[model samples]
Target: MTRSRLTPEREAELYNAVLDLLREVGYDALTMDAVAARTRSSKATLYRQWGSKPELVAMSLRHSKPVDISQIDTGSLRGDFHEMVAQSDDCQMERDTALVRGLSRAVHENDDLLQALRELFIEPEITGLDTMLQRAIARGEIAADNPALKYLSHMLVGAFVAHPLINDEPMTQDFLRDYLDAVMLPALGLPAPGV
Candidate 1:
């Protein structure tokens, strides 16, 4: 069965159903049967569209989001960084949590799934951050080739997402602010005023 057989509307409905299931039951517990039941589609239809569970999950995640990397001029690098940090205080966090957990489970077990997710979900965010940093450089807010910019992307997100999982605490806005001020900005070669 080819994707051409399924209308665009039908595909979107099925994908949205998968996202809903992901939010409700998480990735580990999600199953083709469950998705079929939730979407009111036959399991064979899902199999035809996506050969395996990981493939289905990967496709669902790819379709479920529009990555936002818009220019946010906050008048200063600090303000821009703060705005960027603050943007994650919504559904994006929940989606990232689910994607990270799901991808982590699959990374060691399934190479194809791991590669698909790295290409689809992870690389885009990294590239977007790089673009943001480039814009900052072009604006003279930072050096054109700041070394810390090379690492700020991972530090900003990894600290929030990975550290909490390591230490067993929920990520919060205050923690995000603290991390941005103490870790991210400094790493990006920006110090607080009069420092």
Candidate 2:
């Protein structure tokens, strides 16, 4: 669907309002009326722009992403990964982690939301990550056929969800940097930091 061309500032405002409502009410209880009220936009305008709550929520999540993984090219996979982690702020990561955790149950139950998320958020992220990995392969940093590439996305997502659950701590930049150095880089056959 072609999105309505709102000004970037207006679009960001709407996305922020949607995310705030989602945080306050949860996905199951969030409504277009609530979003309209919060953003001072009409229900028709929201529907015209996004088509549904699922799409709106998905787009909002996409808008809130801190870094574009595809753009990082530090001449080495390790540097690229570390740069990606460094671009994210610890407090913002905590908030985003909490938001995703809240949406997780709703995403599982709502097929529309799941599809929207896959289309609007997950696929683009995967494509960017694939680009980064492909660059690494071309640079001889990792084998193109490395089996680790197959499970990379799963491992990353599992790390995001599992960190808070297992460690009872927010997924900070430091933790992500450590994870890349200890787990992901090793799996992809990259040398450990300082080695």
Candidate 3:
């Protein structure tokens, strides 16, 4: 936590501090002073390094939840989607949902934060899934220009995002698997799992 240089461990500590504060206070209520105090870094250092709160938060997100589209290729579209859900940390769903819900209001109101979120978190996954769909189309399993392809991101993410609003139940790993098999696969005109 030096003024001019940050070791790798120190940087990670700072990022974790930012993410933890974000979870605790949400984006709107979080402040640079809080981040500085939590990370034991000076406010001037944060400003000099990141320039603003949104940028710092964005960098924190990008550094922490890096996009890795390459790991998702399971040879078939169904397998890929299944792997995506299966690989998710079982306990993380609730925390992830809370973070999403907490950021929901602020993301809409702040263009900078929204743009950063889209670039860092949203679009990478969407683009990766879109690539997977295109691969299916090339294999002739999915028809080219299928309407379902257009809404794939919403279809997958909305299940998690809208679950609480639609019902009292939280989206669990089992629920995601069931929803994928029942709703998503069918919507894409894919055969049922294990068929």
Candidate 4:
């Protein structure tokens, strides 16, 4: 990939424009021309930086995430997770959910998109969660090499998708706390905070 001479500020603008267009028009419908017009950059620049629509959107999705999973420790696993969950920005979450909804159809059929989603979106969060689990194991809170370690992050994220589908509730902090107690902790052989 050719290096972009664009400043960090300019690069962020392009990423934001890509996500904004993805939310508005979706992956298949989102054209490089539209992104260029929206970001006020030339089509040649975007093509040079990202090479294709899939690559542009992939890079945008990767950049949108808060990649710093540092500073998550609060001693206990549940405590760490509660802190993580409590940090949710509802508006951002809603935007992300909408982005997924918009791209779901095309994502499933397109190999490039599926690879991008896993590499850029899914793997980073999972890596963060895996780091958290490793910390807990070091503290003797969780057994090292526990099988549940692998699926923990997926389940935590999947809960958000499942909650709205099975019930009429949004993933408010209160409900997620309950879910942590009722579902997550029990599955990992950990007790809820008060229990």
Candidate 5:
């Protein structure tokens, strides 16, 4: 799909409005009309730019993050992981976690949203992670055939969901930093942090 033509400031305004609506009413309840009204743009323009509500929501979520995981390169897998954890502050992580949790239920029931998320958000993230892993393999930080490479994304994503579910608190940067040091590194057959 072609990218949105809206100016950066206008696009940010629209994305923020969409996120606010998502927070207030969730994906199921959010409507194109509401987004149009909220952003003060006609529905046609929104559809023209984003194609649909699911795409709009997915795009909004992709835009909300301050960093793109794909672009982080710290010259080592460990450094890259640390950079990822350090990208978001505690409060932003909490909000983003809650937003994702809210979208999870909706994604299951809506095929469009799922596809949109995969195309606009999830797939890019997976690709970025794959690149990061490839770099690790090239640097000899982890063996190319390390079994844990296959499950790395699952482990990281699990860290996000499992923390709130198991610990009853949103996962923070500190928690993720420790998780990378203790779990992810060891699983990849690398020494623990500071070793």
Candidate 6:
């Protein structure tokens, strides 16, 4: 069947409907028919805009809110680490909810979706963190070539995300702060203040 063309706004509405469907039904059970019904659109329209489930899901994730790393600076390295931990904690709490778990499952099932998500959502956040580290280096809070900078993103965000998925405990600010002080700070060759 020939597919009808959609306006940009209609496309965005359909994409949001896909996200809502994913949240409600999960990736494995999500269907184009359900999405079309929810958005009051048609299966042909979804197919015309995005050829498959992976493509549609990937596009929805890509258009989701972008991360903002604009507020990160505390006079000393320890302070900066604390601020970063707080920022990461807040970001995780804000964005990495059950919906993300659904998206994660989708990506796991589809290689193309996985690649698109990494390129669109994950990489940019890492790049923004890298830029923040560069600023710290310029301010001499950290060595220009510190190895810790290489591991910062994973240490700050990855561990938190993994713990709940692996062990089922919610990540709290207290745990994050303690982790930064005991593990991350030392790994970077920096000591917490008064230590």
Q: In terms of TM-score, which candidate is strongest?
A: 2
Q: After superposition, which runs of candidate 3 have C-alpha atoms over 4 Å from their true positions?
A: 1-8
Clashing pairs in 1: none
Q: Best to worst by TM-score, what's the order?
A: 2, 5, 4, 3, 1, 6
Clashes of each: 0, 0, 0, 0, 0, 0
RMSD in angstroms, all models? Answer: 3.5, 1.1, 3.0, 2.0, 1.4, 4.8
What's the true lDDT of residue 117 in model 2? 98
lDDT string for model 2 (102-133, tens) is 89999899999999999999999999999999
Cα lDDT tens digits, model 5, 37-146, are: 99899999988889899999999988987887778889999999999878889998898888888898999999999999999888888898898888888888899988
TM-score of each predicted structure versus truth: 0.75, 0.96, 0.86, 0.88, 0.95, 0.68
The local distance difference test score of each candidate is 0.73, 0.91, 0.79, 0.80, 0.90, 0.70
- Write candidate 4's Cα lDDT for 1-195 as tens digits: 865598989999999999999988878889999999999999999989888788788788888875445468888888887887667666766676677667778888789888877887778767787788888888998887667777777777687777766785555677778888888877777876677
Residue 16 accuracy (lDDT) in model 2? 96
Query: What is the per-residue lDDT of model 6 for residues 1-195, given as tens digits with 9 covering 90 to 100?
Result: 232466668767877888778878898889998998898877887787777777788777656543345355565556765676565465445344556666766777789777766766668767766766677677776787777778887787676567677768766667677777888777777776568
Runs in model 6 lying further than 4 Å from the true structure: 1-17, 44-52, 62-66, 70-95, 165-167
When 1 and 5 are scored with lDDT, the better candidate is 5
Sorting all predicted structures by lDDT, with the top scorer first, yields: 2, 5, 4, 3, 1, 6
lDDT of 1 at 13: 90
lDDT of 3 by residue, 1-195 (tens): 233587778888998898889899999999999999988779998988777788788778766653365467778877777777766665667767777788889989999898878876777777777787887778777788667878878887798888867887667888888888888877888877777
* Greater-TM-score candidate between 1 and 5: 5
Q: Give residue 27's lDDT in candidate 4 (0 to 100).
A: 83
